[model samples]
Target: MTAQRDMKEKNPWHMSGMVALAVIGVIALVTLVAVMVIQNMPLAQKYKYGIVLDAGSSHTTVFIYEWPAEKDNNTGRAEQKHSCDVKGPGISSYVGTPWKAGQTLRECMRQAEDNIPEKRRAETPLYLGATAGMRLLHMKNSSASEEVFRAVSDTLQTFPFSYQGARILSGQEEGAYGWVTVNYLDNRLKQGLRTTGALDLGGASTQISFVPQALDGGGSPGNSVTFRLYGNDYNLYTHSFLCYGKDQALRMALAHHTQSGPMAIKDPCFHPGYAATKAYSDLYDSPCVSDRKPQGAPESFLHTGIGNFQQCQDVVRTLFNFSQCKYSRCSFNGVYQPPLQGHFGAFSAYYYTMSFFNLTDTSIPLDTVKETIARFCATPWQQVKQENPGTKLKYLVEYCFAGAYLITLLTDGYNFTAETYADIKFIHKIKGSDAGWTLGYMLNLTNMIPAEAPDTPPLPYSGYVTIVTVTVFLLLALLLLVGRTFRPSCFKRSLII
Candidate 1:
C-alpha cells in the first residue's frame, strides 16, 4: 500500500499536477493565438499622390489626386484632393508670344507645389494635355503649337513633380477619357455597373461617348474603343465634332448670318440690346468659317441681337447636316452612333448653359427649356448682367443664344426627345471633382485602372475571427480531455522499469 501510494504520488497526472498541466497548455494555446493575431493585423496605411494639368481652350486647370499605396489598383482609391484654374486664357491663347504660356502656368504650379507634401513632390507625376484649341492651332500653324509645347514643358520640368510629356490629346482620346471619367467617378467602372454616356462640350469641340447595347452596332471601328476593366469588356462608341462647341458654333453661325454682306447683322439668338462686331479675318481663321469667308474685300460685320427663340432655333438647325448618313443611324454629319443606351452626362458648357438658364434639374422638357430661353432672351442685356453680377459678360449675353442652341442641338442633332430628355443630366462636378477627361487620362497613364478585381478572402473578417476562436478552443479542449483521460501513472511505472 505504501509503494502503491508512492506510485500514485509520483504520477504527474495527480489532481494538482493535472491542473498545472492544464494551466501550461492554456498559456501555450493563448501564445499561439496571439502570434497569429499579430500576423493577420493590417499594416498602417500609406498614401501616394499624382497631378494632371488640363490646358483647355477657354481656360487651364491643375488637378491634384491621391491614393493609398497598398490599394494602387483598387476602384475609388484615387480621389481629387485639389484643383487650381490657371488665370487668363488657355496655353493655346499665348500663340503670338509662346513663352508667355510657360509664365501663365507658374501661379497654378505654385499652388500645386504648396498643396503636395515635400516628400511626395518628387514622385508625383505631372501631365499637361492640350485640347481642341491646341488642335486647331496645330492645324493652322504647327510651329506656334510646338513653341507653345516647348514653353509649357519647360515650366513643368522645373517643378519637383515627375513631368510627363505635354502635348495635344486626339479628339478620340479626349472623348474616351471623358467617358472613363464619368463612369469612374460614378463608381460604375469599378463596381461593374451599367455606365453613363459622356457628352463633353469644350470651347472648340463636342464629344459623345457611350458603351452601346449591341457591341457590334457601333458603325465603324475607328469611332469605337475597347477596354477591359474589372473583368468586364466595354465596347464604346465615341465621336468628337470639331468646331461644334458653343463658342466655335457661335462663330460659324455668325459667319453664316453675315454671308449677305457685313452690314448690321441681326442675330435672333442674342438678347435684343446686345451688339458686337467681329472682324472678317477673325471669323475666317476658323476652319468652320474659312469656306464661307467673303472675297478679300470685306472688313467686319456688326451683329445686333433680335432675341427670337424660334428664329434662333432655325439658325442653329442649319448648322447640323441631318440629311447625310451612311449608317442606319447617325447623330449628325454622317457620324455613326448606336441608339444611345443608359443615361447621359453633359458637362463643361452643357452644365454652365443649363445651370445659368435654370434647366439643371431633371424632367425639364424641351418645350419648358425653349420657353425659359425665350423669356430670358427678352430680358434687357443690362438686367441680365445685374442678375448675374460679376459673371463673365461674354457668357452672360450669350446665355440666351446658348440655351437656344443647347435645346436645338439635343432635340435636332442628338435626337434626345422630351420623353427621354430626363436621362440627360447636366453636371459640372461629381463629388467635388470636376467631371472632365483629365482625371481619367491620369488614371490610365498611371495604370490605376485595373483589368480585374483584386483577390479577396472567401470569408469576411468577422467570419475569420469567429472561425479561429471556435477552432482554437475546440482543439485545446480535445488536447485537455485526452491528457486528463491518459493518467500520468504510466510516467511513474516507466521510472521503475
Candidate 2:
C-alpha cells in the first residue's frame, strides 16, 4: 500500500499536463478554423482595392483594377483577376452649375451589374477616385466644393462596397503607373532598350515620364523626367507645370501679348520645329493673301496636315528645346527680354517630340498608317462596345499613342526609322472589335513580346509612392513608440511568437 501510494504521488503531474495539452489543442484548432475562414473569403471581400477616377479637364475615366490576388496557402491557387467600371463627366473646368457626374457613375455601375452574372455580381468590390474636375469644383471658394465631394462620398457609401476619394495622381505617377501597367502586362522595353519615356497629351494638360533600364548592377540611375499633371503626387518628385497645355499655352501666349502692351515681337529663341511650328502655324498663323480669300476660303489652310513620323520627331525635339529658349523682344530700345512661352506651343511641342523624336525610325508602312488612321477614325462605338463590352475606345487609342511613342524612342537599334522612311509598308487591318487591350497592337508594332521585361527596374521619379512610403513608415514608427507608454502589453503581445 505504501509503495502504491508513492507511485500515485509520482504521477500527480499527469492531470496538469493533460489539461495543458487540451488547452493547446483547442487553441490550434481555433487558429486553423480562423485561417480557413479567411482563406475561403473571396479576394475582393478580404482585400482593399483602389479606384482611380480620373476626371480630366475635358473627359473622365474611372479605372478600377482588381487588386493583385494573393496566392492561397491552403488551396495553392492564385486569386482570379477581377474587373469593375464606373464613369462621370469631366468636371475639371466645369462652371455655372453642378452636373450629374455622380449619377453617371451610378448608371455605369448599374449597366455593369446588369451584364454580370447575378451570383458573381455581388462578389466584386468598387471604388471611386475624382481628379481635375473636383479640384476645379472647389477652386477658390471650396465651401461648395467640399460639399460636392462629401456628397460624392456619401452617395458612394450607399453601395454595398465602395470608396470615394480625391485622385490627385502626380504627372510623373500618372505616366509611371501607365507604364507599369503596360510593361507589367506586355513586357516591353527590356535590357538595353528598357529606358522609356512617355508623353500623354490632353485637352488641358500634357504629361511625360522617363524610365531608365536596369544597369548591369541592380540599381536605378538618378535621372528625372518632366511632364504635366496637376499638383497631386508632388511627393513622387515630379515637375508638373500647369497652364502649360496646348490650349493653355496658346491662351498664355495671347495673355502675355496683352500683358506686354500689344504688338509684342516674336522671340526666335523659343521656336517650334517644323512639325510643331506647322501645327501652331496652321492654327494661329495668318493665311497668305495669295492662297485664298478672306472669309470663304477652304478650311484646309487652317488645318495642319496630319504630321508624318519625321515631322513628329522634329516637333518633339523643338518642344523640349523650346522649354529652354530665352526670348528676346525687339523693343523700341535695342531689344527687350522676350516674353515667356505659353502652354499652346509648349504643350503641342511635347506631343510632337514624344511621338516623333522619341520613337525609333521604323517607317510605319504608308499603307499601314492610312489603314490604321482610317480604321481608328471610323471605328464605330457599337462594334467596339460589342467586342470589348465596356471599355472606352478613346482611352485605348490614347494608350496606343503613348506606347508607340515609347517603343520608337527606346528601340533605336532596330533601324526602324530609316526603313520606315524608305520601305516599311503600312497595313490597316482591324482583326476584331474586341481589341481593347492596346498592348497587343503596340507590341506588334515594335515586334516585341510582352514576356521580355519581367523584372526591369522602375523609374526613379515614380511620383507619390516614395513620399507615401516614407510618411506611412514614419507614422507607424511614431505609433509604436507612443503606444508603448500606454499599452506596454500590446508590445509584449506582438512579441509573442
Of the candidates shown, which would achieve the greatest lDDT relative to the real structure?
A: 1
lDDT values, one for every candidate: 0.82, 0.34
- What TM-score number comes out for model 1? 0.82
RMSD in order of candidates = 6.6, 19.8
In TM-score terms, which candidate is top?
Answer: 1
Q: Per-residue lDDT of 243-312 in model 2, one digit per residue for the tens?
A: 3334333333332322323222222112122111212223333111112222332333221123233433
Model 1 Cα lDDT, one tens digit per residue, 1-497 = 57668866665566776686578777767756775676576655556777888988899999999766544333336678999888889888898998888998899899999998898798787888989999988887899899999988988899898887897999999999999889888989888899999999889999999987774543477888887665667888888988898889988888778776666788888888888876777877866677887665367778788788889889998899988888878889888878878899999999988888778986867688778889988887778878889788877888887888888887788888888788999998898788989878866765643333344454577877776787677667858765665655666556666
* Model 2 worst lDDT run, 10 consecutive residues: 337-346
**TM-scores, all models, native as reference:** 0.82, 0.39
lDDT assessment of candidate 1? 0.82
Please give the lDDT score at residue 80 for candidate 2.
17
